[model samples]
Target: MVRGLTVLCWAVATPGLLWAAVRLLGVERGPLVQLLAFTPYVAGWSLLPVALSLALRRWWPAGVAAVAAVALIAVVAPRAFGGGSPAGGGGPTLRVLTANLLAGAGDAPTLVRLVRERQVDVLAVQEFTPEAAARLDASGLAELMPHRRLNPVAGTEGSGLYSRFPLTATGVRENPGGFTQAYGTLTAPGAAPATVESVHPAAPYSLGQLRAWERDLDAQPRATPGGPIRILAGDFNATLDHAPLRRLIASGYRDAADATGAGLAGTWGPYLPDQRHSSDRVPAIRRMAARITGDRIPPVTIDHVLVDRRVGVRDVSVLRLPGSDHRPVYAELALPRAELGG
Candidate 1:
């Protein structure tokens, strides 16, 4: 019994150790390897092996698992609990909200209510469908946000940006895989106009999709700290653990949630029912199970509000939106006085 238990402990510890090594090495070549990039997002699962090793009194295996947990914690803990830069002294504050409409199925009235309640200055939406756009327009959002740049597509590729300030449609960034992103300049009253992009990279579900997602992320323009203050807000389909997003951050952009110590809050999970299931009853059951289990699928933070270093992220929060799998992310930002067109 002792020997068998020891073998079981090793079996549990090896996989986590290997995954930790992969993350440390930053190897994202094939589909399987690319999937490993998300291991850190679910790093909490590593504790299972540690618990097992401790129960079996296997110190070496327990130590190995503990090290694996520590390594992952080292990677994620700073973002989860680290200190952010102090808020800038003088500048106009802009409150921005971003949401994925779940292919236009999100509740229009609920969204409008959020905008009004939060006093959002800029709103960015991904997976915008024409019907959803129509509903949003009719919900009095247009009156609140007169300046708009909408590119409503058939499916999940559509994107839109609305602002209380003036907006000039720059262009639509259409990926080869049919992923469309809309960007424009938002002219605030006292601040120099900033470029804002509604970002939604392709989901990396398979090898081809992974390649496309990588391409989409790599194609994003880098932010120039001293130049125009740029904001990229939407569902990135990649997390901080991904190498491409890390590179993007290294290029002078900062995630608003991270800046405000809200990075640990998850925005994506199994809240919405899976529409792909053949039977409606199955989806209902699945949702019920998820609710009962407290959504044990291990939620991930895929949606973000990224801004240039010159912008100060004063606060960040996440809201649950009806009819959507993702929670809406809102951030209050302040630009430096020099960038305020003083």
Candidate 2:
């Protein structure tokens, strides 16, 4: 029993250690390395091995696991607890909400409720299909958000932006792989007009997709400090762990969730339970598996709201939407009076 347990301890600890090393070494190059970039974001799972090692009284293995956990925490903790931009002098607050409709599977009623309840000033939707656009129009969203820009595509690459404030469609960026991002300027009362973009980069599921994803991210206009404030929000399909996103953030923009210490929150997964597994036995086991593995397939923070550092992020929150695989991310931002020369 002791020897078997020792083997098990090594089995778990080795992978954790290897992951930690890879993460710290920044080994991103090939397809596998690119996939490994996402590992640190889910590093919370490392604690499972740590807990097991401690339970088995395996100090050395426990130490190794602990190191792995510590490494992950070191990478992620800053975003969760780091201080954000200081409060700007009194100015108009802009409430923005971003959601990925999962190819228009988002619930119309829920979306309307969120817009009304949150008093959202700016709304951005990804995967905005024509059907979803029609539903949103019928749901009285237009009444609340009078100004709008809708780029309804045939498939999941569609995107849209709606605003209570006046919105002017600026341009649309189309990337390889059919991914589309919509851009607009929102003119809010008593505040300088800010550029807002609804973005949806392609998923990095393959080398081709990964390169396209990087290109899309790179194509996103960088925010200039002390310049016009820009809000980029939607399903980036890449996390802070991705070099492209990290570089983007380092270039004078800040993720709302990270700015507000909500960076650890997951916005994807726990999708409407699979009907095939709806039976009690299968569903329960699936749920158990999800719990055990952190639902790698279902749970991650791929959706985000990124704003210029000059924009004060007051708060950030996530809400589950019916029929969608992703949660809506809302951020309350305040534009500084000085930025607009108010």
Top-lDDT candidate index:
1
Q: For residues 1-342, write the lDDT of model 1, one tens digit per residue.
A: 989999999999987787777677766667644465457554778899999999989999999999888887777777676357534525778899999987787778889999999999999999898888899989989898888888998668899988888888577888766778888888666776788988998888667687788888888878877577788999988877778887887788899998778888888876565323322222244446546765555677899999887777888999978777789999988866644431
Clashing pairs in 2: 269-298
For model 2, the superposed segments whose C-alpha errors exceed 4 Å read 1-10, 29-42, 47-66, 87-90, 274-298, 338-342
Identify the runs in model 1 with alpha carbons over 4 angstroms from their true place: 29-41, 54-57, 86-90, 274-296, 339-342
Residue 43 CA error for candidate 1 (Å)?
2.8
Cα RMSD, model 2? 5.3
Q: Candidate 2, residues 184-289: lDDT per residue as tens digits?
A: 9877777777899998877786676767777778878798776677889999887777777877888888899988898878887566453233222222443454
